[model samples]
Target chain A: MPEPKALPFSARDATCPFDPAAELYELQEREGLPRVPVPSPIMGEFEAVELTRYTDAKDAMSDPRLQMGFVFDPEQPRTMMNQPGNLLNYNGADHRRLRRMLTSAFTVKRIRGLLPKIEEIVDSRLDALEAAGPGADIVHEFSTPIPTLVICELLGVPYEDRESFQRRAKIGLDVNTTREEQIANLAEMDAYMGRLVAEHRRSPGDNLLGSVVRDFGDQLTEDELTGIGNMLLVAGHETTASMLSSGVALLLQNPDQLAVVRDDPEAVGDAVEELLRYCSPAIALPREAAEDMVVNGQWIEKGERVVTSLLVANRRIPGAEGDLDVLDVRRTPAPHVTFGYGPHQCLGQQLARAELRVALPALFKRFPTLALGVPEDEVDYRTTALVFAVNKLPVTW
Target chain B: MTLKVEVDEQRCVSAGHCVTSAPDVFDQRDDDGVVHLLDGAPPERRHEQVREAALLCPAAAILLRERDGSA
Candidate 1:
């Protein structure tokens, strides 16, 4: 087989943090699906077909023959991947089975029921932000805690353990972290989740994990419960937290759009959707071809990997309205694969949307004159993580 | 101009796009969280919003049939 060509693909542009690297857009214009070298800390460097167009992305993601389980090497000792209930570790029937177990936990109705609690969390965080006065790191003071606390409450994880879990979650998502560090962090989190699962086994509470123990305890193994807890714990907060911080920075840059999101209560939902499309938090969703297939006219052999760039796919030309690359909160709702597409699309999307819909507008309403504490150029954007986010958004009202 | 709407519960992922678009016409069952059609034939004025709701459904589970037999 001929060697795959290496393409320059970075998650975000240094010049424009919100946009994908210009080279990716150029590649999309020329070749919609190009084979490129993707480096992983666990598996080192390998070739994967990169899908950049919106239609092609949806097609590849939705194709059952393309499986997510093959993305990781069989030899890898990653605990999360080896575990049973880690949804990303399985495909087809196994994936559907595991996914069905948790579906009700994140349903729109269930999430809406949590709104009062979410509002309380948002309000308390806003109160803390107010007490901190101006020049606080919005990332640490505001963005991180709301989701952290909410997810903790949902999963029945003790609020006191958040700092440790949050740290591990950060290490887990960072692409630049060494494989050893990733394994160590995953091990620590697994141990922690094991204890939580054991506690729930003794006495189930009202939260998701507790409910699982109560409802499906006999059907599930201890490892499965731990894996489920860890997946929800990490995925529950990290993506939404990244969106919160980065969304703030994006809104801060576009003041007029910020005004629309803040002033019009009815517009918050659409604004959140526009922000999800524009920001494109989770960068790429990786899958592997289980069989020989042609996607967007590009042939792929069995066992070859395919990675969909959510950033580029969502930003494809002729967006919902006006330019796809630009951030306009007023744009009509356009379908973007930010949460991904197909059967394995984000299960927590409704929950994430609920948090964003409430958190963004509430933050802006509480601090109407919010602006960046540092100059625009100096804001640190996390470039090497699976999820795109700001390192620290220093802000002042 | 009443509109007929039906939801295939098996296909629904509970993305909530339908309910968000037209809360009055669509909701989710409290138990499994699948889409529950609150109004099979909504009023004339709500047809456009119901159509938008069907379009927004990621699962394509929501089917709308207009009174004229047009979907």
Candidate 2:
């Protein structure tokens, strides 16, 4: 196919780092969707028309004609990218079959059950941060470890084996990595998670993987189990970690908002929604148009690829009471597309929400006077990554 | 005012946004976590929450229709 437009868009804004690239918002106001090129090692390269408006983004996503990603091919050897159990890899009936098997484990009620554990995890991380006594990297001390440890406990993956999965998870999400490197990392992850699945088979624990094994072991293939295990590990941790670190960075820059998050017990829930909507950590997967469809009056032909800047959509969301560009924690939450929309919407969303609700407030409450340990511009932000994040967040209380 | 609700169990990926938005009107199936509509035709007071729940549903599983209620 002829290469689409050369209108490649940067994911981040130069001036306001919390927002999507300014061009995306500009594109939202323009006459039509622009064809944007996305190059990735795993899926090679593809050109897609971006849907920037909130209504368009939501409609295009939930529309049945626009599929999640490539359909899972049973003939192909299962890799991290194309596997049986990973819901992101399939569409329609096949997708529902895999997703239903684990839905019980990720329900809002099930996730709420983990609140005590999540609270414990958050407090321990705060203790580590306090002991380090400021000038510490919150990425390391607070953000990264909380979700990592939470997923570990939830999946029954040995926390000691986090080293094996964490590094590869980062490698997998790095868009700059080569195909060979990605393939090698995928294999390593496959084997690592495969062992964890095997371990669960022998004696099922009360965690997610354990519960799946207990209920659906007869139905699930080994590859499916491994895929589900690793998908949760990768999807569950890094996104939340980035959100935590970046949200903290965003909050710290706006002290009044930070105060709202810290002092107000009833407002933290509202605050996390604003943070998710404002920061927009999860970059949505580029979608393939399964059939010709019109999104917000723009005609998209069949076989076309479509993309979305979720950050822009969140900011442009209709019915929001205040300025979209500014951050307001106490404002009523808008229905943002941060967790994405449609059938492939994030499975661990409730768990992620619960984690942030507990973690973010607890971090600030523990250290009443937290401030950036380094110059504002000195903080390294991970912009080009699949998940927008902070490389290291240096802070002092 | 009566708020009538319908849910497509097939479409729900169990994102749980519906339940979060309107817990009294919606719930999740314990077995599959798909949406479980607790109140199909709710009273006037619940109309707003139920509307919010339908809008917030990521899967777009919840659909709402309105009809005048008879006292």
Candidate 3:
């Protein structure tokens, strides 16, 4: 690499849990796009030009020239990341074909229709939290279960199958798991989904996966259905669970901010957006450049990788109002890259928004005096994982 | 004022941002959730929302052009 910048991509400083490493912001503030060596658990360490500016990150994310699913060889040792139906492993036409089949289930109107069910799920979780009483971990009691239950219902996994689904949900989120362990866990996941998809094929249920099988069965193959089932099940629940947990922690730390979210019904939508921006839960996975491209007047070479730091790029959005360090619950929602941009933008964003919009405010309303069960300093944040999350959030209200 | 609005269904990932931002001007298919432009030339009153929809679109699939430039 020509530049002296080497970055530990997803490491979060305990002292400042909300931000990426300080060097990342500096690279953004510096003049030209810097080709920094970034270490990846999946791809090992490689030189990737950082897209830290808001415009550059947004534009490049959607740019056809910058693609995903090409970085790692799928069959070299096929893992869940690129299994046949996983959206993360496909680009262009192939990506569109797979994604469009699932889009109807996640449309904004579809999510709107789902509000009552989501509310029911949130309320049930709240009841569980109250039953657990004081000294309950929100991760287990509130945040985690809400999304998982909702996703399970959406995917139409039989009640019996969810235990298996939930058990392996965190496998990909652990930073220290060995690659062999990941492959084994993924293999287990593949087989499980395979069986589920097989059942869907025989007699499609009313759930999302069942509906996909019901509606588009002939167009998709067995492996593709299995990949879609697993990816949707995993990505759908895991991302929201982390965001919910982290947003609760962020709000609990800032009582004034939490007050706004709790008291104002109108503020919930905007509050969730701010949470998505301030927390920026998921990191943008690297994309391989198929050809040389210039973003923000800087050129990236063909075959080089590009990493857009969502945490940094989100706060640095040029016209976004208010201070970056402060989490404003009432801030007008900005065009943050939290759900990403372009073709591969998150498929379940509307669904995630609906979950957060309902869950966060409901948690506070139900437990008005919610407080951290452990001391603030004792809270654990899993920064090294693909999704930044609070591992365990013990709460008492 | 006439505000022209168009949606590239091919580029749209059906994030429903346009529908959320400007429901009058944009809608999604019942099947695949692809976007459809409800108003090719939205009236003056709906111009601001139409612009917001275009801005918020994740796919950048919504295209907008202003005609009758004078306000």
How big a share of the true inter-chain contacts is recovered in candidate 3?
0.85
lDDT for each residue of candidate 1 in A1-397, tens digit (9 for 90 to 100): 5432222354577687788888788778885467888876555677888887888888887788988764334476754445656888787667767777788888777888999999999999999999998999999988899999999999999989888888888888766656788788888988999999999999998889998888889988987898899999989999999999988998998899989888998999889989998888785546889899998688988999888787888887343678887888898878888887766778899999989989998999999889999999999887777777788989988
True contacts kept of 2: 0.96
- What is the Cα-based lDDT of residue B5 in candidate 3? 78
Q: TM-score per candidate, in order?
A: 0.92, 0.95, 0.95
Global lDDT scores for all candidate models: 0.82, 0.84, 0.83
Determine the TM-score of chain B of model 3.
0.89
- Candidate 2 docks with a DockQ of 0.86
Per-residue alpha-carbon lDDT of model 2 for A23-124, expressed as tens digits?
787898999888877887776787888888888988888888888667667676445567667778788888888889888988989999889989999998
Top of the candidates by lDDT: 2
| Each model's DockQ score | 0.49, 0.86, 0.87
lDDT of candidate 3 over A1-397, digit per residue (tens): 3422223555555587887677777777889887877754445567888787889889888898998845335557756555788888888998999899999998889999999999999999999989998988999887778888888899987656666777786776555466787778888988888898999899999899889998889999998898898888888888898999989888999999999999999888888888898888887778988998888789898999888888888878888888876788888888788999988889999999999999998889888999988888888877766777788999987
Off by over 4 Å in 2: A1-10, A73-79, B68-71
Model 1 C-alpha lDDT versus the unseen true structure:
0.82
Q: What share of the true interface contacts does each candidate keep?
A: 0.31, 0.96, 0.85
CA shift of A173, model 3, Å: 3.1
